[model samples]
Target: MTIDEQQASVAVIGLGKIGLTLAAVFATNGYYIFGADKNKEVVASINQGKSHINNEPGLDQLVSDAVENNQMRATSDNVEAVAHSSIIVVIVPVLVDTANQIDYQMIDAVVEDIAKGIKKGSLVIFETTLPPGDTKNRFGKRIEERSGLRLGTDFYLAYSPERVYSNRIIEDLEKYPKVVGGINEKSLLLASTFYKQALNCQLIEVSSIETAEFSKVAECVYRDVNIALANELAQFADQTGVNISEVIVASNSQPYSHIHSPGIGVGGHCIPIYPYFFINKGLNQGLTPLAREVNDGMAAYAISQVKKEVGSLANRNVLILGLSYRENVKEPTKSTTLLLIDQLLNMNANVFVNDPLFSDREIHAFGVTPLSLQDKSISKIDIIILQAYHDDYKNLNFKDFTNCKLLFDGRNQLKQEDIKKHGITYQSIGQQSEKGEW
Candidate 1:
């Protein structure tokens, strides 16, 4: 029987940002998509020809077109999706607990459901960022025991880590080289061929599934280490009265010298979380752990700079712009603002936060009063912390700060002269205070 009689061309289990994008891309490639999501609202939204993720560029139109053309459909049942598709792509998240321990509960549950519904001769490709050997050692083995299926015999399993950034996933999919490795030669060959034709882009087929897993973690760890080094250099620059930003520009002119910009902290789901995977390997845990420690301490470093510049924080009106981890994105996973709020509140400082992306209720959820951009809301007095630097602050005139003493540009995105021209001292990572800078 043809695909229409029994199964779909592809099944995408998970309709989150990455998963939905993959489904839409697959649909655009002429493969009928069967999307499975536990969140009923997400499934309903997709079925109604709409995209739940609003921030991803060009996603809504893609989703609408896919659904409109009857090429894509979503369901709440994972088993139903798997049973109706010949090729299954799983792209679920593996979260970490408060103790920084990998919580495999969610992934474990999804794997079990896949094992229950995975069909004979169907290929299951995981697109999640997992620890090395999880697909082969744990998941593949478990599927064998639970489903009575033999790898490379009854079914095929492969690991292809998702390597795309938020807000640019669709573009990155076409630009970045897709990495794929499988439990065996046959699985690897199958996944590689499928991706080479489907993505119509560069493909890197590694030796083993474990290698594919390590590649993703290694990428994240390398970035974390680079960022941590920049933060350390920023600290040294502050002590030595050197401009870290200036140093980075001059140093990077060598081409071989690639120095990252220093920020308040590395606060994202990937960089901060994946370093623990590299460290937990229990081998030569050298720079990975150290980098994580340094990046995690940067939030406190920002607050320490504020304390040094303005002295007493008690009863001080401190406004924090952008509560999200970074600019433009609404995701607050492991945000630096959380750390800042804790320290500022402990110092008895009146904390006010604002992110154009987040609602007032969400801002209040952080235990800080929401600061609107209006002049009445701009009644901020003592300190202003530019945490995430959203585009809303781009044309913002500095004169709006009625009695602001210091403008701490956490990301170094703002023009220093503009703040200084308005009589407000500007401070940022790696730079001395505005008046104190050389």
Candidate 2:
């Protein structure tokens, strides 16, 4: 089918953050979109022109516009969505199990559903992150077997992993160059033509589907390793009385040096999780597993620092600010803040959590009492851990934390001299305390 003919309809499977955003993007670009999800509530909400995801910049108005213009519709049945469109884009998540193994069950189940209704000449593109060769080997074979059709002849198969983060989905989709690869030359040309016409972005066609799959995994692994290096350096700096942040800034004056900051721990869906997709496939050259180890231990390290400063946790009321993994995002997927809370509870500390993005009931569900920043109880807290660097907490006056004895800046958000001027013992990830005595 030609580009104009294929633009008539597009089906997006998995109506989560990425899936729903892509559906809205396609709809706004003039294609009628059919969005399918297993959640009945999400389907109903989308059909009613409401967005189920949170904290995305402009998704609500985009979805409303698409639904009002008759450019988008949603359903719970995957087969129905597939039958209504010629181009199918899959954006389901592939997660890692507790044993640090890649879990293929979710993607496998999605392919089975798509196979039941996929028509001839339809293009099936995968936007989920995968191990090196799973796209061409596992997914392609599953579609061919279930549909009783051959790839590249009766249907097309391609891989183009989603590279956008949670908060900047729409902007990144339009700004970053898209990497696309297909099982064959015809599939490549067809997929390229579709994305170029549908989105305002440049497409980089690679040699094969495996190359594209590896590219996404490689990018995430590089970040994991870089951050791990910074985390390890922070440990060394703490022991030697050196400021790791200053060292990093001075070293990065060289053109080739690009260093990431050290945090309480690595969180979010992409960096902490994507490395295992390749490591479990026997690509562990030792650096990947070690990086995961260092990043995972950072949460416990932050808790220990709190204990050191406060001297005891038996009767102290500790307030943890920010529950989400990162600033400004409402998603807590794989957030290290949860781990810190668990550790604090186990130490018998009375923990009170607060985040402007999450409701009090949401924080309470995690087995901790939620406190508002304006509550009178804030002045009575013994310690404050700034787990997330939200913009709302950036310019907070020192007067608000006067009653707090110790403040642990987990994200390095507060200045040391300013915090010290308030008479609170300040500790951060990589910087040494100015007071010398905690």
> What is the clash count for each candidate, in the order shown?
1, 0
Which residue pairs of candidate 1 clash? Answer: 8-84
Worst 10 residues of 1 by lDDT: 1-10
All candidates' lDDT scores? Answer: 0.87, 0.88
How well does candidate 1 match the true structure, expressed as C-alpha RMSD? 2.1
Q: Estimate each model's TM-score.
A: 0.96, 0.95
RMSD of each: 2.1, 1.8
Q: Residues 1-438, candidate 2, lDDT per residue (tens digit)?
A: 454665558889999999999999988988899999989999999999999998888999999999999999999999999988888999988988778688888778889988999998899999998888898789988899999989889999999999998788999999999999999999998889888877869999999999999999999999999999999999888888888888999989998998899989888879999999878888677898889999999989988877776677887899888899989888777888889888888889999988899998899889999998888778888888888888888887767776888888888878777777778888988885845353
